[model samples]
Target: MTGPDRRTVTSHLLIAGMSAMIPARSIAATRDPTARTRQGQAKGFVRNGASIFLGLPYGADTGGARRFRPPAPPLPWQGVRDATRPGQRAPQPGIGPLRGPFADYFTGNRSAEIAAMPETLGEDCLVLNVVTPAVDRARRPVLVYIHGGGFTTGTGLVGTLGDRFTVAEDVVLVTVNHRLGALGFMYLGGASPDFADGNPGMLDLVAALRWVRDNIGAFGGDPTNVTLFGESGGGIKVSLLLAMPQAQGLFRRAIIESGLYPDPIAPQVAADQTRDFMARVGASDVAALQRLPFDRFSGAGTPGNLPVADGRTLMARPWAQAPATAANVPLLLGYCKDELTLFALGQPALFDLKWPDVPSRLAAAKLGLPPEAAPGVVDAYRSVFPSDTPSDSYFRISSDASFGRAMVTLADLKSGQRPPVYFYRMDLDTQLPPGLRAMHTAELPLTIGLSPRADADTLTKQISGAWAAFARTGDPNHPGLPQWRPYRPAEREMMVFDQVSSSGPDPQAAPRAMLREAIGSGAQYNPL
Candidate 1:
């Protein structure tokens, strides 16, 4: 058969196969005929003159023996693997009751958005969702996203839909699922052979990267030009991946939001936490631990949880030790305006501390400050925010100690390597009833340029344009947006995203200085 005829026959077969996988009416209604495949099957839906494909998988079921092991290659099928449905999410313990706004957010309430809930949550949760403008086989820049959950919980399924970014930027967007918490991070070498040393979760991330490098081209993504970006725990994972030897060259650029490696944790303390967990669960062997019921292994206070500084996988404490390997990759790091306010929900007393007493409480918490330094720390904070009340002062100190200082410290270290590092401060106040003002995860909608009203064009072409530019070419500069200068100790230029976004010098200058001094130059501390 001629090449054209062969392509036509192949496309037809693929369309037939995909039709069997999903609803025929939905496909017929939404699929673009003009953007048709060789077999006359639609590959994407037309949105503002661009075609969009949602939820394409990159790996197979990670169940049974595949659990705790590297992601297996997705088995090839005859027809187009329904690239529309999002695969299952990894088993994660739910936090609080799922209702109201939380349920709406998790379920994707947008009328234009497609809901891709996982059929099951188990060890077999290794999968990825892809959003591409077209499937014409032309390699486009790829953005591989990792979701955050304190290295314990969270799935790629939450709060990440590429529809806005994909159509707005005309780029391929990929979000992945990896092992989390104990099942992902537990180091088993000391107890069993199959469950040997190193971080299994990190390994899962590397496996996903490898899968992207190998197969992204099939979905119109440039494997060599992938960028890894994440928020919170996901940001921390990106930091770890930068230090990991296995992740080298898989991704070219990175964007970390609200989390940094330099946030100190005592290695021994983490190990002890693991030991206590193992002891509590009554599992001395790795096999037995693996065999534990999923429910028993999940949730808070579980054994063999959280990423450990196992010397091999985690070369050194991320915050204390400079990431020599990732030094060359361009980085973008930042935090929200009122980062600590979210913690007040769980620890109400956090909001009660007086400004002068903030430093003392933090020092006592073993946040790298000496006991005697508490008074001076408080004084320094007061001097910085002289007009602020005790509550404001306390929140500033806590936010800096936990996230802000660490972000700056990492950026400072990376800046020394001569790599372009961009910084930002998200100050937009959503004013949601929860009273979270620019809190963690708040910048997500802005980053993706999503708005509440379907008819409203709140999609700022500038933000999405910059992100697309960055994904396309390692730089976020675009038309109508101010030139984003690389972060430096001297200038400390930060891109502020708010009701009005712009690039400028440090806005929280005094507070930032006090944090740097209190945390020391490296912001390093032994985890208690």
Candidate 2:
């Protein structure tokens, strides 16, 4: 892994006597193998007996005029494209300062870790990675993973757990990176017609799907059977793709894990973007906004990266209506038992709450519940979980509000229709820190074989079995788990996943009423 003795390679030219910024090991390890993607031939490396291709471009340069618009097809190349080095991530704020114990979760401390993170950011970020048992094999189910960071941060790099889905699963795993924040989703309709319904970030995902449709076969995948699966923010994209007309027919199945956001793209972003955009880049007009350096414009992402309903690509906000476009696409939706604690516990009061502080703290938590609704929520939680403390109750209530409700609601909406929705809940204990049981993103490493505990492997095997079966047949039922049932509006049925998985009635019925009353209609919060 020494940083030495190398050559420079760009899209067109390479110079001698210059050091290759990528590690020397990566350069030598991958120089022998090559595969033809739709855009061009890509050079790749090998790991764990799998062909590991990194940073393969799926769209053209997305800077200057191309900023804040749908992605253009990648420019075809004359020579082989070098995909050994990690591509630059979309520009957004990376992890800020952290406090005690919890900092371990963000630092990526897995023993079977992937390679390092990309050290730079750029607008040329619409690239994807491919990991296959062998490019020579054909018709294998393709898993196109959308990395989570909402409409903003996170890349399809090693940091996002891309390498974990390699040969072990016998599916071609594809991870993608696209535009984020202002450069990807800020609405500037006055600037141009193309930028009217601003959701360039979502469009980037659509383009990536289109790329998969055309080129995944070369990597030993069945493009017709692509399964779009993601976690956290990535799961939100999978849900959006299901409702988006532009994303129709690109894939056949969807899996959403702990993703929650409002269904429709917001009609108008609450934050004043016009003033912020102008202030950040020293540009008052869309014309001038295009001329500013992308780094400046993208880094100054304020008001967050929310998708706008421009009425063309998205007719209504995603998830608001039954997804007619995805009527025939089977869906598997689930969430971790204590999904919100990873984020909720960051508030010191919630890390461990005293019984006396419970009342005032629950109200002030501002979980979108009204003051009048707080007492009822407290009462219901106390009745259902008698032995639980205030902190435990808050964690469970927040989990149901943010993630659990959405899973059931979407499942009910998609049930008794063209394609069925199967629901599950991950309650496995990895025995991790803070003792927040089954916390958010805890299943990530386990599903990909990073688990150290013996109890986790059984659930991981069942999960992997279900995911693989779903990718192949659009149904997740297998002998590994109990008799899983498809969700129905009239009947409450869901699979509770653990060391010994089994079926049960919808677990949210009682808590949901309280949550809806408190949060008004239903709860919605974009995972940060």
Candidate 3:
């Protein structure tokens, strides 16, 4: 708990004594724990009964010419590679600890969790961390988690959550680190032949799944029973993978939590942004752009730096059509009720917003709702949560417009396919500030069994049990929780996770209808 925060670590590294930075208590040394990956042997350690492996590379270094292209396979190594500590994260814009009104909300007011954010970063960041009951061939259900940072920041290190999920659920927990921001998603096909393949960030995930398919068996995982799950940006990645051909048969199940990007950047828009980026960086040619150090422009990011609907890697936008290719994969998707509260924390005015200002504020949020229709949206939301304040209603309305509607559309699109679809909405109160009710990422720690609240153990058992059940079979329903029904248009049933979880039909009907009327489409505006 006394360890340096992310900013402090970076500051120490910036100074000359980085080599002398204090380290955490080391794990007891025992050379008996090992796993043979296809690339090479991995030397891990035993902790609380699980074999923990950290920082195993699934792809080659993506620094110079390989920056914007498809990932290459990691070369084979001769001897055991040490995986005792966390791996390097992809270079991202902000590498410091957050210090504002938003920090408490994002970190759940946990100093240890904030300090656990990995400090080391580099371009060769396509690594994964694994925690398993053992390295034997037991064929446990594999749960691969992708971290969320809005396609910009974050790494795959699972921290305490990884060990908890692995041991409690008896599953192999694998967390991955892929390219973020410009390095992973920037479209350069319109500029040169070498960068024709866009969405290298997405490609990095596909490569990781392939690695799981090939090498996970050696680490006591059932390659055929891999379940892909992520939250926020990581959730968006899980959603995008459903439509990708290369990611088709890599996994058997998918779970998306608050990760709906209704609008991926268009190819032309991505190209325009690429040109602007080149000009801003003063690089006239592709060669010059490639030569610039990653830190020089790691902070440069735009909306255009998202996944592109290029004809090849990604044929169309995710959820544009029924994922016919992934028809057999059962899906579990949902979002927090107050999804936008985390983003709203930094703004003081939002806390004191009045009823008359609701419409303008909603319109200003740019959730694709027309300005004239804002009043009707507010009225609709008021009808649902009759006692909510104007500020509370504003947050709920905007969250539904951006996240709730898209999740409904995706569930609708994936409905009636060969495989079943399950839906839910996280409504658990975080016991934080009053306005941050069931804020974004509140379900993560609880579901991963690392929540600091002593009272959350019961709900965590039910939630994490459902996830493990889904990974084991196709259904999320288990004896520990209520009977969760597959989503059907007629019933529209979804499990609502809270202090006392229950099944419900159309929890946000009024506001959903209003947003659909206003925007004419159910999907738009994904803010991470």
Candidate 4:
């Protein structure tokens, strides 16, 4: 069957099981429940005592004129919308042999997940998934999550499973879908008046937040008490949102994991990149570019896309200069140990290099420490990690450049503000692959309590509890776990989350200190 017909068949099959599985509960009953949306009036399941509304449209399709532009509101429908199943994924450019331990994480389980993905590309990609404990009118705190994929790939559905937070903390969890890559971040600053801006993906996020602020009460969530949290690219998006004026009052708290916004692309740089991308695709105008095949716009050959400092929407560099508007929002920021290990696994050349050659290679990329700090940085790392090899140094260097330094930089900057700042180092290793280490995104399964292995259950429970507690209250401190103190300049206390969690002054002291000094002193590492 053709794409459209296949989508219709899939939608029909998904909706068929909705009625039998989702029993309606009375509004006044102890188990408060309600309909999904006006169009897809499908009832939600009471799994683990929480009601879920899946694939609820917050904005209309981005087809034709709508593509590459800001998201538009969904059209009003006649009846309850069947929000029983997930909506189609945003159109992604297909390309390359997927690399690394997390390649499948991005390509998704094609046979299982993408087969159910919506087939057609359109303006209708703006939708959200929500899980809440009750549909009563009582307003519970809400957590709006944005997923991460280096600004090129990923969906909210893939990273989050809201059952733990919703049922455990009695909070509402909302995950949103937004434009990515070229469609999201193409800067048209000098090209056209209308397209003369950056961060279209971020704009989509703000639109989703606006929807939450306006309509979340209907789903038993408080519009005013919202927390924005994400991992990797999602975390970077949160950092950008923290700096955005439009997103200021929409969220009260923020959690950033393995990402920060210190190295936003300058507007001129973004425009130049856009020019190069257009040249590659043979498109002279926005209209011509939009008309190209969606695959041509998205595939592996597509240029890297990220939020740009457009001067208007994005007022200033987020990590470098704190937005005056976001100065007061409480922040929980952190990174996973061995974050770059997975990314480095895909590039064997990095693994083959000699330990002594590591510093020179970094210096060649302008990411070297000052001559004074270079030997000390290497020595400090080696002193702590006696058996460290070139591969380990590669992981350490890349991790610090892309995620670790960024995390510390943001924390240090934000610590000077009013609202308290907290940080952690996630050391939980996964069972997926040995070489993966405590790689980036490994903390996700644990934080969301989705790990299927019996061995990981204890860790999952602890981490999930901490996250839920933080969602419920601004603080992440729980009863059984060691006290996770706020990140203060004096003590610099950080929680080390592992099989046996601990809290003290900077566990990775030598590496963290060396990285902080190196980056502060003009080292030029690439931000992932």
Candidate 5:
């Protein structure tokens, strides 16, 4: 079954670019549990004692000619805006089929999550939510999260993380929704000079940051102390924003949790996808394309939405190495112990493979190495894990090749930065099948202060505290954790979070090196 096919997805405004956008007084507006903005007023209710504001517009609607253009400024209203429910998610192909019996187990939702989503997928999808404990605090550190989906699926879900993140940590929490899929990122630049700016989705994030810089102070946050964090695709975005000059100074700190460094799609690759989109929609020109309804454009069978290096919104190379411009920004990077189990456990195709099949399968997908080198990589992992079955070896190597390499590469890039870059490995095994141990996104709900449980109480306190401390002071050295030294190339140190949590030096060094030797430097191109 295809993952997130044709489906969905969705920062900060640059301080320099947005100086005259919103007034300075707007930053210090009084918080009455009800707040006022330059555009209008919004009343956020209390939940578990935290104030909550849901679905306030941060950017203008994307419809008609505005579709696929850089996000426009939010249109102002005459009356108070009612921010009660979540804003509509970006238009997307729904998460398609799940083949295996335990497919729902892998996703952690049988059908309940899809059932819970709003029925409407609207065009005006640029809105955001804020949760604060008390509006009384003058300078709270802010945590603004961009939801994951690899630029394809996931919404900026609304919640009251206030009890956990805001009240306990005293940091404000903000979640945002931007455009996604073909709606936000269809590359029509070469064909239509009018649509030349390539990264509209990234720009949407910039608009949200602009909103935060001008408005978050009133919600009890410091616009100057904002830290952007996300897991998976969201984490990828956090890293991308770090390199973006347009998003510079919008966020002072960043946490990249299990995110791959996405290289912008090459021009021909984007052109092919655009050609497919145009053919599917029967549009000959960009004007005719914009005239079509959103549903028709949304339905086009196309590739996953990824960014492009048009030299405007993004550099020619997308994080080919450490980002030179944003190297000064403090960063925390990490991934789950079994990052791909979130996908692999449900994939019988991988689990059911025989030893003879592994080489051809790896070659077919070009997972890490060519067919001739697959045996060497398999042996490499066997030397590393030792006890795992052949299938387990395949999955582990794939995980390392994709996400694990990205983590180490980022650590390698930022090894000596003075501002400091931190690294971690989440080894927390779950109650699910052992093969699904510490799967992707396993740390999200608790780490961000979602559902609270007595079992996860200690874990939550530790992980959340590290995140909170990092946001507050750029160092995650709270009393709860081991002294997490800044990652270094020689030692390759990283904090490993598990039941018996501890810090280790070069935990996966042997395996990462093995793959690097086999795949060469091209290993950095592995899609995370």
Candidate 6:
């Protein structure tokens, strides 16, 4: 689904990088909400009492010569542009039907959600969506979200529509779509001068943030009080953003859900991956690679879109040391209780494992543990949850190895700094199959302020309200929640979200210790 080729507009003033401030005069109310941006004016419609705008260009199309370069500013337009429909998604291989035993359960049979997904996939996907309660100068809080598909698949349209969140919390919600997969992260700096930057996907996000800083004020949002958050891959991106010099001051607060890894792709590893990808596509040079059909790049052996340590854009391991830039920015980090269950659904053998196979099954690559430590890790979890089967224990142990342990380490590292760091564990079980407790993205519906079942309304209000409160200030505490304290090494306090949410010390203490020991030093740990 290649979009129409866009002609390069003569280089105009790039308003996104400018430091000029918009005057705070009261905005006049209009019949149909409209806002004039640096590029041009856009007209949006009111939906369910919120002024909604979709598909506003934040950066120019990354097709042709712009494939692997830093994102360019969007071209100026003559007249008012319509921004009422969803935008194109980044070009990548089709993520065909969800597979495995829990496929239907994973999707929850939500046909409406399946239908709302973006239809267009192309290189011209540097667009974003905005939803605000009003077009007046109310100066509401802004929540800017980056969608998660591990930097390869997915778009802003997937789990973060954010309409309900904006209307309910009176905050402006923005979701952005940027380059993904090889097109976005392929390392070409060592190969040719034409492709010096290998981390364009990360740069695309920086460009989008610059656009938000410049243009969000006109849409009834407080540009100074923006919160940047994402789940999974998006959370990893947030972690990386904390280390980026270009992303400084673009956001005030950050929330990372189920994505906290300490290491980024080494420069040499990224270059090797790029060479391997080029060889797979039979392209020896940048021109030959660009001339091939886009699909050919994603067909087979596509390199993972992990951000690279280019020594410029990203200096070192993202979280190996506390980023000085993020020292003042408050952070919220968490993961679901059973993050690996949804992923394990595709592997039938994992579900059928018996006690004898627990150690072997837990020794998989994602565990990030020594082979000898699997037995001890399994024992630690079994001691915590006595009624567990071998498979259940495997799920919990593997999840901690991948997400929980790393988040704990990160919280510890960040707590040493002055800024507050809050940690959480989502324990809401999916009733679809009953035992799938807080699988990977189970917190999305509630966090994004979507309507939940009758039983979940209170929980939704608690979670979503807390998120809004955090964005409004740096604290996640509100009347709906108990006195939530910042994470500290002595107590390791954390919020647990469920049908009834609560705050306490580490819930699974033994397993956390076991996994931490298995992975050796936290600074050198890598889990993606």
TM-score of each: 0.81, 0.86, 0.90, 0.84, 0.86, 0.88
Instruction: Provide the clashing-pair count of each candidate structure.
Output: 8, 6, 0, 24, 10, 0
Task: For model 5, give the 10-residue run with minimal summed lDDT.
Answer: 10-19
Model 4 agreement with the true structure over 268-328: per-residue lDDT tens digits? 7777887888888788988888787666767554654667778877755555655677787
For candidate 5, the per-residue lDDT at 434 reads 32
- Those runs of model 2 whose alpha carbons end farther than 4 Å from true positions after fitting are 1-31, 96-119, 159-165, 264-272, 298-304
Once fitted onto the true fold, the runs of candidate 5 whose alpha carbons sit more than 4 angstroms away are 1-32, 95-119, 158-163, 352-365, 387-391, 451-454, 523-528
Candidate 2 per-residue C-alpha lDDT over 1-528 given as tens digits, one digit per residue, 9 for 90 to 100 = 121111111100010000111221233344356888766798877665667777888898788888776789998887988876777667765442222222233222332232333337788888888877787747799888777766666666532232444566677888788888778877776445656766788899999999999988888889899999887777878888888888999999999887775454454542256556677667767778789776565444464466666676665556666678888888988888777666653355575877666656656655676766776787787887798877777777777777777776777777857787888888775454545567776555444444445556677677777787788888887777788888776667888887777797865567667777668763465445
Kindly provide the TM-score of model 5 when superposed on the true structure, using C-alpha atoms: 0.86
Q: Could you say which candidate leads in TM-score?
A: 3
How do the residues 1-528 of candidate 3 rate in per-residue lDDT, one tens digit apiece? 232343433221111112111122224535547999988998987765678787899999999987777999988898889887766778876544434333332333343333342547788888988889889899999999887777777766643334656787889988888888888888888888777788999999999999999999888999999999888777878888888888999999999888775356778888998898888888898778778898765664543347887777886565677767779889999888887876775576886789999999998897888899999888888887888888888878887887777788788888868789999998887755535677777777655555436576678788888889999997988887888999977788999888789996866875787677898853478555
Report the number of the highest-lDDT candidate.
3
Worst 10 residues of 4 by lDDT: 12-21
lDDT of each: 0.62, 0.68, 0.76, 0.67, 0.69, 0.73
Q: Could you tell me how far off, in angstroms, the CA of residue 175 lies in candidate 3 after the best superposition?
A: 0.5
Please give the distance, in angstroms, between residue 405's alpha carbon in candidate 3 and its true position after superposition: 1.3
> Where's the lowest-lDDT run of ten residues in candidate 6?
9-18
Error of 1 at 423 (Å): 0.8
Q: Which ranges of candidate 6 are over 4 A from the true structure?
A: 1-32, 96-117, 364-366, 433-435, 522-528
The count of backbone overlaps in candidate 1 is: 8
